[model samples]
Target: MTTPARLSAPAVATPVPWPDDSVSVLRNRPVRLGTDPASLSRFGDDDWNIRPAHRDAHTTICNLNLRVFPEPLRRQFRAVLLAALDHPQPVEPGGRQRSAEYIGIGSMPVLARGLQLFAHWMHLQGVRQIADITDHDLDVYLQHITGTTTPLRQQANTLNSVRTLWLFRDVLPASCRLAAQFPWPGRTANELVGLRTSNGENKRPRIQDDTMEALLAWSLHMVEEIGPDIRDAWQEYTLLCRGEHSSQAIYVGTAGPRLRAYVDQCRRTCTPLPGIPGPDGPRINYGHVLRLIGLDGKGAFSPAQKRWLAGQGLPVAEHSTVGVITGQIQGRPWRDTPLAIGELSGLWRRLAGALFTVVCYLSGMRPGEVLSLRRGCCDTDEATGQLVMHGHRGKGYDRAPDTPDAAEPTRPWVVVGVVHEAIALLESLHDQPHLFPAQLRVGMFRPSATHARTCSSVNRDIADFAAWVNQTFRRADGSAPIPDDPAGNLNASRFRRTLARFIVRRPRGLIAAALQYGHVDTKVTLNYAGAPDTEWLQDVAVEKLELVLEQISDDAQRLAAGEHVSGPSADEYRRRVVGSADFPGRTVISPRSAERLLGSTDPQVHHGEGMTCVWRPETAACRAARLAQGLPEPAGPDERECRSTCTNLAFTDRDITRRKQDLHDLKATASDPLAPRPLRDRAAAQAERIASLVHRHEQHRNEGAPA
Candidate 1:
């Protein structure tokens, strides 16, 4: 923190050599430089090799012109500005060879602006050279930059940028360079002191379980209805495009006699077939009818035939061509036909949109990963009958192998049953490289696979589907329709968080617990077991565990402040967390730390299936665990152990609500006349236990209520 001498206007000024065209770049623009414009004519040089043609660079130079300083000082400032304008070094080694230097790039404007601010501050303090700055001056400059509301990280970035000004030492005069010293040591933004803040992790919104269920239910139904229709339409179009006209016209067996009857009727009455629209009017040409059955060469329909066809509600045409159906044409090439094409295309879009929702939500894959999925990515596990999907990591491509032509790394996803069904439906729609092919608005066939729909499109499809369901569907009783989310936001990324929350709350030994999450690598793991693209699941799990601990601590404090808590383990929980000297305030305990400390001391906290356990090992009341071990430490409650009689069990608000629900259901069971006597008595006892706990908790809360 050495102080340098104050500076004043220098005795002699040196001429600055700059390009003649530099004035043309800034003369018309109203760029602010925070200093006098006359000061700029002193020091720019033509020797500066950086681009004067680029917009950002040009503007920066123009703004730099306004910072009026002595010639020597301006030279050091210009050198620092040029250095900071250089392109960033490539981060990945594999792409380094392909990288090119960018012109008019980098944060030149930001650098210029910071320099201008620093110059103004320096001007106010009468500091003209780098050597004149002191540690106290640097401290005051930082204080001025970082306002009361400025985020610590942003403040750190600004300070880090200012640190680069020290590089001007190389360009300074010998006397100035010798006296110049940076107040703070150069360090990374993260490593710098005062940048650290206790701001909590960002929490994204997750779709509620009930809302997710409703969405899936609607999507599943839509898939069932339209999936088969789309598949059939595509199949027929394929057959027709290949010119299988005769086979497409009729079905064999019992329909042969019926077909003959229809043809014979058409021949006898000289009428047109039903469901076909004609040129101008709703009637058929007899000559055209005869030509369809190989009678007339001209293929003309008579007035009698037109009248008969019109009576049957079929449109008549003057001549026979490709579109005119003379028989049952279920398998006909109908892609070229307008009506069939429209119906099929609409169905296909709906099917793709619905399938996208099911796949992304159930698999919990990111939208980018889902979009990257190819046609054959989904497959069945032969032995276990589980659905597995393969997709590559989209965001962390830098983790890929550094080879000349390295393939993008892939991962597998263990998907649920409904997702597998959706994949199957998508596959049935068409045979294409991409699962969701790019389709033209009017065509039945896919256009190309080169450009797949992006995540923005995926999000649009989700919102559109939600809107469609809300508008089109109704409850069976017609009492209440499925409501949209109050927030009116349904994003594709939210599905990952929704699924993670769903998995974490599932019961022990469920599919979630059995599954492993985190990045999967190696051929065997990718082919058989899925590796998650990220460790977000683990992070979320840790966050949830910490949340549970925090909730317990809050409850303990409430109990200490004369608030009531009426679980079997409430008293013990209070003693451990609230009464303990180390347990104070809102503290976050790491998952690893909690795992190490759990059940280690007296009145220990134990995580179980239904409730938390806080009990003395010797006096543990969990009958199943106690009987098996006959000791408190080893006799932790089993998943199936009695929650009612266990003295170590504690309840939070959600748990209390669950308890009330249990009480209600048990009362309903006990009041049933059909229930056996033993069953009724058991139900009554369980209900009474829950009721007592609820009553005690309510009474405590009422006693502690502010009056």
Candidate 2:
């Protein structure tokens, strides 16, 4: 069998040309600092598109890189730096002015700020190479980039390391080639703008009690001057405050960077966080900025983190409290009176302006979640008419782990009866649809399915609102302590803590009633679905029905209970109703494994549980077996035989045992292709894939390469 000679190959079909230097540089496609080929390939061609809204996968990627970075920095670098690198380009640098979707000024600011910071780093490294660079040029350039004034430290607080590193990567890639006659000749290290930890007072934006007081006083006067209603003007003003207006604030950076600065300033009083040093540079250490996550040395308060500490009795957090009690209300703390905020221009315009404070104190809903409420999400239950808070996420979103997703991701959230009253009161007055609604006009119609709200925004709205409320309302009793303005001011997050305190300190007789605090306690635990309340009985019943098919074993108990017990369809139970009438619901009971096997083998097993066993006298298998075994077979013509007396073969314990074991073996085999053995071949395949990835990563590492 000689095969015809294969056609001669034409001189190795012209070898493909390698990428040219210019094209290579252009197509460099900067890799995420720790991107691995295996991961890249796993994503196939969508390497840059795998932007998970949450940080888990990215955290995993960064955690893998933790070996390179220190524990303190691993998370921040990954969260900020790696994220910036992950997305190489912006969809739009500033924002789409004509976007009908109204993508908010808030939504784009952080990105702008992040990009600017990254650019700053690159600019620092390339400053020497750029033509005619001087301090004046640098100041103008930096203000242009960061949106701060001549003294970078004086204007406002900035995200230090994260901003710097991001600026470093992003700015250089685009502008390095466009330096026009000037060349960025410095080494890679010099090109990166580094941060030094400054203990200086100006570097940190101080949101002191006095500042808050002044702002409140300023707000009140502005509101009074507006006279009655400035609904149209107020709406625009709020939009401007959110940096949504075409008219931008006078700041060092662009309109976006200015908003970012606002966020930074606001966060100082909302979600106070410890400052991390810039990548490869000294950290801007402001002892004044308090940290929510405490410091190691004496656990000194990070002046930055003081906002959350407002109600926490922290000395540093007292500043905000003083302003809350004095400036906004001018009413004594002991009086159960609310000073009108109507006079204050923008004060009444904010959704969280006042009502949220009372709600947080009484009901215990998280300020952020409460603020984020929409009109229709709150409903009075049809059965009990209890106020139910519904959303993907809002307040009271704590568990023990500090997740970036906390209170940010919208998920199913419930507000208890306490929140109900306040919500009702607010609804009766205001008609905004979005809860914790933003002043930015462009972002309210819909939500981004891709990302969650930022922690800073969530915190800021809450803190500012809390301050207004505390100042607006006064306690009747002189014993009630006034909020300290310098340190403590109302913040959205303080609601959770205040809630916990309330539950613990509830009046002696009202302990049980405290469960009404959103019903998260025993009502909505993992062990149960929904609340124990009767309203959820139907849902629970259906869930239990599924579990019975998966986990239950008692057949007589199941049958006598009168459930259909053996059927292919769940809809059968829907036809004839039986469970608890108090709880009208659906039940799902499917054919048992043994019944399925028996039915398949001998089609006569068509009976639901609790039904009388059918005797197929025409061709009884037991009678036939008895006849075959030398016992007298029933003479059906004359009609009587003792063969029917054998109860052992008719639904006996031994038979059931044998049948159950058979079903177990059958199910076990079906569950695993490699049956009779515990571990399946599929597990081995998964192990091999993971091992391959590890090996590939190791190969790169052995050669001193980046991940």
Candidate 3:
């Protein structure tokens, strides 16, 4: 059970010159290093600010701090990381060059973090230099990371970080390079760590229907009702602060009379002096009073004046109670108490969060894309009157010389009117170029150093907003406005998935219908998948194919239970379902295989309003209409053109039950004496045909039953 001694690395004939000082691997050039001179020194500094000079305002600056690594291994680790940045590794063994680009600056921090973890492990194993590490040591390290509680994806990343040592061995200085090839060669990090590769499925959990409904409802209430008041209060507070900081000469000239009139008016109207919460009791808010009177300094009010104001018999309260509360909840005032000056900032944050929810959920924009939106990004199309959001795609870009920034090409998202309202509110909330800035305000309009709110920050905002809604508002039955989602906290990414699910489930729903006929031309494709700019189309296609397979499986189960199916295509339905009964539910299927399974002839079941369509193009009644419209032959029945006597119709027991209900409704209408004569005759004819269908279904069911 003895551990083997580490072996020395092989010597190199021509050693690469390791620089004692050089520009950081992150920066392409040190053009605007700002006040930090250490940014230019590669080996001298531990903290490297990896923020690119041309970075988008929405993207947060990244830092790679080597301070966490042990001092002895720092140089060696730095060499490996710099080599990774300087060189391009093959996409695969002997594969074509990957976009002929170096690793992106954004990915450097994550890579550095993984390397730092490996350095610590190496230190623990008494292997100081990468060259001293042996294959056996790497094998043990792999096992160590695998055994940890870290997720499989992270473990794979850590392993890939170690592989970099060997990947760039030729470029590294002889002493810093791994002599032996990385262990587990020919196997990917995913395979080694047992991380399953994605099968184009969107595993992001959709927010439950009730939860989404409640969340959207409360968000709409905040935007439509409470938002204006919050905005007005913020504007007033900002102006008061601005006026307080005005020049002394101007304030002195206007202060004397204004102060006298303000005190006199407060006393006359019996209005309370604005104050903040105090330990002893409510005390006069001197700052607020000074700002209100247009005074410049804290000592603007004298002792005699303060005493005179205190003895005026005016009430003191945390906030001005004189303003009208316009927002309501459950037919009562939304707030029984006035909004405190201190609470204004929290209200502003909540308001922004609500806006974010509305825009993100309604537009199906990624969190980053939403954050990248600028003040004037949204506009109404003049031709169609459709709201279109013009923003850059934050993903799916090749890290090339021409486009080095985070944003991709400008893309348009067809949004609803409410999305435009949210964007307008955001534009008014902050003066920053980004619609969702990191800082809303700090007494005055000032953009944050980071400029934009990160996705992680927006996530917190949304979660806090939900909690705030539940705490502040209640339903008629006394329940939280937004129920807790079992999928955990609702995030930006989940919104897209939830939206896709809803679009698929209810294509005729308000949002879906609007998107369908909007300028975006998002019909079955986008409704079943995702927006044009997103990768959701493929994910949705996979989901749809899986759904079809699931339906076939369900049909098999029903048939196994001896359920009767009748119609022209009933035998066809049984044959297809029985043939595909062995189809696996969650197993990985290639795109080609999925396409074939979803082909017109395979598992030919299409559920319609009152029947199951086992489509055969020649027998389909909807085929002629599609051809007349110059459209391609349909893969399934067009439910809009479905005919009662269509030969491809297959009626299950469920459809029969629906038909029975339809027949009852028709009979009632046909026998109505108050109905017009022609309408009654039409209803009577339809009822007779429906009755015949129902009778035939019952006869078929009885004949199929075991005797």
Could you say which candidate leads in lDDT? 3
- For model 1 the local lDDT of residue 168 reads 34
CA shift of 333, model 2, Å: 20
* Best model per TM-score: 3
Q: What's the TM for model 1?
A: 0.50
Per-model TM against the reference: 0.50, 0.28, 0.75
What is the TM-score (0 to 1) of candidate 3? 0.75
lDDT (tens digit, per residue) of candidate 3 on 1-707 = 45434333344577787856565654443222122444344655777655533234456656678888898999888777777766765343434346445666666777887898989998887886788877778888988999999999889888877765666777789778777654566677898889988755456788998999888988888877788778767766676666633322233455556667778767777877988777888889877787776663545777877887788778898654223468776677777776677888778888888899999889777777788677798877687676688876556424221222333446677787888888887777767667887686643222353356778877888888899988987777998879999988888778876775565445532222223323223532343123444354444444456566656777789999987888888887888888888755444455444545555424657665567787778988887777888976655567766777788888888887888888888889889999999998998998898888778878878787421
TM-score result, candidate 2: 0.28
lDDT sort, best first:
3, 1, 2
Worst 10 residues of 2 by lDDT: 318-327
Ten residues in a row with the worst lDDT in model 3? Answer: 510-519
lDDT of each: 0.52, 0.34, 0.69
Model 1 CA lDDT for position 229: 55
Candidates ranked by TM-score, best first? Answer: 3, 1, 2
